[model samples]
Target: MKIIPQLLFVIAIVIFGYFFSKRVIRIRKNIQIGRKEDRSDQPAKRFRNMLLIAFGQKKMFKKPLPAVLHLFIYVGFLVINLEVLEFIIDGLLGTHRIFAPYLGGFYTFCLNFFEFLALAVVISCLVFLFRRNILKIPRFWQREMTSWPRLDANLILIIEILLMAAIFTMNATDQILQTRGAGYTATGRFFLSAQLIPLFEGASTAQLILGERVAWWAHIIGILGFAVYVTYSKHLHIFMAFPNTYYGNLNAPGQMWNMPEITNEVKIMLGAAGAEQNQVEAPARFGAKDVADLSRFNIMNAYACTECGRCTAECPANITGKKLSPRKIMMDVRDRVEEIGSSNSDEDGKSLLGDYITKEEIFACTSCNACVEACPVNIDPLSIILQLRRYTAMEESSSPADWNNMFSNIETNFAPWKFAASDRFNWSKE
Candidate 1:
């Protein structure tokens, strides 16, 4: 009987180690995708940004309710891990109430509190899923008709439910195991366990024991499987959000969009005029020629996507049916990243700004900053598109006639509107 817990613990530990190591290696490979050397010299600014974004979650609140709910989910998950730690100890070491002495009544209180909070998170996620799927929020819908909007939402809900269920069962199992005296005082505090006890009145010891084992194993298996799922699905945000947020830009949002000097050097070296330099020496032209041109951060952006479709919901081009959906763009980027990561062949190479992402889509952008402002994870797709445009205009000299004329007018007249300098003060005079 005692050996079961020890075996579960060892199995859990081994699985954890294997997954953790694999993810670390994958992230490292992703970081090398775009391979831009770190240029920030301001240690203080970087440190402050790391603290604020990673812990403060400043960027997440652009969509307030979802942000706040997600924040609670994160904190609740972290706090609840202590309960798991205690479970492993009790199950394996025979210390049934290990955390009781150290945490006093606090562990009990937190277990109950976080359990309820976790429930709220699950409910909120369900609402979000409904909004995305049944309600058919237009913003999150993809253009290729290939975006897995419903699947994405369903997966997230499943993860949240599994996590919450695990917590509920673990608590309930403990309650049953300690039926003689309410087990631990902490166990009594959990509302789920308290409610469950009444239903089990007059149950046999063997039945109770069997139920405990079932619940215990269910909790363990659910959590273990969830850990694996996170790495492969959009729910990867569950683990990556903190680290990604920590590395977030500290500078003003606008300032961070500026292409680094390395990008410029690459442009010049390749004789690429504008943003086209992003494709220089690259097999495919820049913007996002295949997925290798995309930075690790870009890949992270996809996993971190909450499928809120705030960017797509706000995109002007989508509203006009111009074939540009920011949400679809994100999905495409994610697909490309996965495709490249999984294959050794270069057959999938595609231009970032060409047929892969149409010129109309490129020109449709207004540089209005709406998409950037709307993204929950701070993904700046607008900047990526613009860089691709720059590469087209500067390196390949392949800009649209209307846009070229507009740029020429801007250089000759200092305004895209083509108004003469003499007429600049006409409005003021009138």
Candidate 2:
């Protein structure tokens, strides 16, 4: 029986590791389907951004109430997961509470701290659920948030609450067993779990041990399951945020980037540089028409979106009842990416521009950076919008007639108005 459990524990670890690694590999491959660009400059600056935004969660504090709730869950989960280190050790060695003897008093302190955080996380999850279901925050009711998106949000919160409950229950039963001198290691007092001792008071030692074992197993298994589920959930941001914030566009949010390839072409055409000659097989697409045409950073941005609807809430277009929702844009990109990434059908030639995102939505953007600024994470829906817009304007020549007229005026008369060059200065004289 001892050998069977030890073998089973190793097998569990291997299976979890194998699936998690495979999902990670798939995500990387899907992200790599996009065009590449270097984000290597200013390493020190990127490090600061990663530290401040990802670690400190600087942007989230802009909204105090929800931010506080979010911080409770976010910080609490991270701190509480430290217990997994000890759990892993115990599982491998077939020992119970492996760190209790080694760390002595400090181990007790750590357990107390973990229980406190676990309680906070449970409370935070409950409050968030109330906000989503009862309070019905307007942003949460956006068109894109219906069906699966809404359920996904609620499901994650419920999972957190359950996971925390498992920890508290496990600790409570362990405390009961400790009093009976039941061979369970005493990790000292846990403030929150101590209050639950009454619930198990009439239980036999054998029954308490069974309950303790069940809760311990449930907590660990739930954690492993959560790891796999998150890759497919919006909660992937929990892992992606560090890298996403590190590669964030450090320039002003409102600042736009000219396509370097197009700029270089223009410069060469105007005889501005010593141009070499031919190119082998670089991608010929000038702007994104499909997921593959987008830059790697933009694709990553889709995955990093929290789908909190903060971006849509801040969007001028959305506020004005226009077709665009910046939040929806990110959601759609992620949905389409997942669809495409998982599809095996060769006939499935769907693309983001026409199939998922419409011209109306893309054109409705006012080019404002409200979405960029409002995002708690550094996801740039504008970049994705602009890239698709570029495809419409340049590759398809599908700009509106008025926009085409403006382009013609700029080309022929060097201004938005169709005026002769000589007459352009005539208005100035007046």
Candidate 3:
């Protein structure tokens, strides 16, 4: 019956692996539903960008205090997970402190290092929770951050705190058991967790053993559960940020992508030389009205968004109290994609443009590209906004009355004024 616990550990690992893999595959499929566009150019530049933005978190440094706090949680959580590797090995072999005998002092040193990181992680989580709930940061309490978004952020912080507590409990109890001449291995004291040893001063050996076992099980199980839950949360940014940064747009901030088909047709009409070179078939639509019409990079951006509201915070239109919130645009796209991916019917009589994101929101954008500059992961909300604008103008011929007037003047007078092209230079005579 001793091996039964090992068997259960193996089974838990298998189930967690299966579900996580399934969720990842589903996300990939959903992202692929959008049209393909080549983002593979400039491998060196892309790699550098991924390193700076995702790994180094260069953009996050814009806000020094939050950035430092985030670094503590990010770096500490990752380092502590290294200890989980030991947990897996011990659980599988039904052994305790499996590496201690081999590494001696080094094993103890590693545990002490992890304890320090765990304390840092716990303290960071508490600060984040206080900021979100007690202080009520404006970005975290935005209209887009409804009940579920707020709850998800708080839950992740709380889970990290509890997981760190479990580690301290397990270490303290194990040390107590070792001193009692129980079967527990004699590892040296971990500096941070050692402070907790006094709490179990008079506990029986059997009780200490039970506490250690319970903590051991809880910590590993909680880590596994957190891994799966992150796949469904805004926390998916943890994994998606790397690839999203690698595939980020390399063009200048103000430069917009034009439809090749339209550009070619315009050249042909003007009888320009080499107009027919590299000519391709026209696309079925001018711009994106739904997720399928958007490029794959745009869809990936939707999933990579952490909903941190940096984009919205930098938006000129949002600052002026317009309906435009760049963060909301990305969130709306992700919600639409999820809805479509999970739907049974192909045509749901709803689209990302009209159903999820409204015309007023898209129209409110000034094409300033501030949101793109503000995004930590290089997500381009402006690209999505421009695509929706194209559909409104070219496909539906539904631009606002003022914009239509400007379009007419540009077509007839070759400028946004009523003066003919021949008289355009007349003002220079003055």
Candidate 4:
């Protein structure tokens, strides 16, 4: 009994250490990549919007079934930690049912309920995997041309499978133990391990003990490994996602991206003529030139992406065969940031507009906010694209010929179309 506690403690510590070290390293690297100004310090509306989207998981509901399934999985994982604690106690202290007396009948009922919910989560995840792998869902296709290691995808699959296997196995083993006269003690009282007893009829005591030990170890190992993997993989969302969602920008879907203002004196000193010039030349300023230009929250967004490809799936640019996937754009930004920080190179030499993201890619965007509305993590790719547009239009005097003509017409005739100013109020029939 004493040995079990020590073993569990050591495993926990090792898992914690792995995650802590990885998190610290990633944070430091992210900081080195740089940060954009804090827009989160804005008004109360922003906070409210972030809360509704992030906490509410509002965007995820675009794919209602998958979203609902994930919601259950997420909540179940969090609530089941209490049962996990009991499992540890059972293993170490030799107490079969550790949580029975505390919450009584009600708690047991909930435990049984969530266990069924977890089974649903497993089924849903399998469906998702099959859709991605066998069905070749267009949404899951790689939008980036660059090569990625298959190992990354395989590792994620393996981890998820292990986690589900552990959950099901643990439940089945506990059911067997309960049926074999391991009365409803403090922990096992609320859980219906009794359902599993019928399956193990005629099994010897030795077989039952071995089964329990196997299930207990599987559960512990799977959970601990999952914790460690969360920090290192794209699954970092499992931990950082909630906080990222909690601190997200909460505003109307299509709100324009704002550029910070520069005082007149600074503008004059830099020989800048207007808001556009001021934005380009301002020190510690405008468009993202390096990783450091991204806000910490944006960096966290990169880590939080589930690679569900919902953003790309909804992007008009991607559908039209343009070299832009809103999904890949986020990924590219992260990659460029890392490149800039590690190499100490200037990304400003590369054009923010054009072939890098492509002119068609920009124009293809209807600014409809479909991608933004679809993203589960609240990544506003439209805002990033607009920032690039602003830099090109203001600093370089570069824009699509059609858009430039429209701007010229708007300035000269006071109308976006080629119409006479006197005709503006023609609706007032005399």
Report per-prediction Cα RMSD to one decimal. 5.2, 2.0, 1.3, 5.3
lDDT of each: 0.65, 0.87, 0.91, 0.64
TM-score against native, each model:
0.79, 0.95, 0.97, 0.75
Q: Give model 2's TM-score versus the native structure.
A: 0.95
Q: 1-430, model 1: which lDDT tens digit per residue? A: 7587677677776887698678667655654565463535676765665566656777677678768777767776777666677767766675556777678777678777877777776777777777667886665555554445557567767767776765666566567667555344444467855676666656776666666667666666666667766666666766666555545445565663544545767667777778553443433444444445665566566656655677877888777677776766666666555555666443654544564677677778777778777765566676567766767786677889988999998988888978897787889876
Winning candidate number (lDDT): 3
lDDT of 3: 0.91
Q: How well does model 4 score by local distance difference test?
A: 0.64
Q: Which tens-of-lDDT digit does each residue in 205-269 have in candidate 2?
A: 99999999889888888898889989989999999998999999988777778666565566568
Model 4: how far residue 337 lies from native, Å? 4.4
Against the true structure, whose TM-score is highest?
Answer: 3
**Considering TM-score, which of the candidate structures 1 and 2 is the better prediction for this target?**
2
Name the regions of candidate 1 deviating beyond 4 angstroms.
91-97, 101-104, 142-149, 181-186, 250-288, 345-356, 407-430
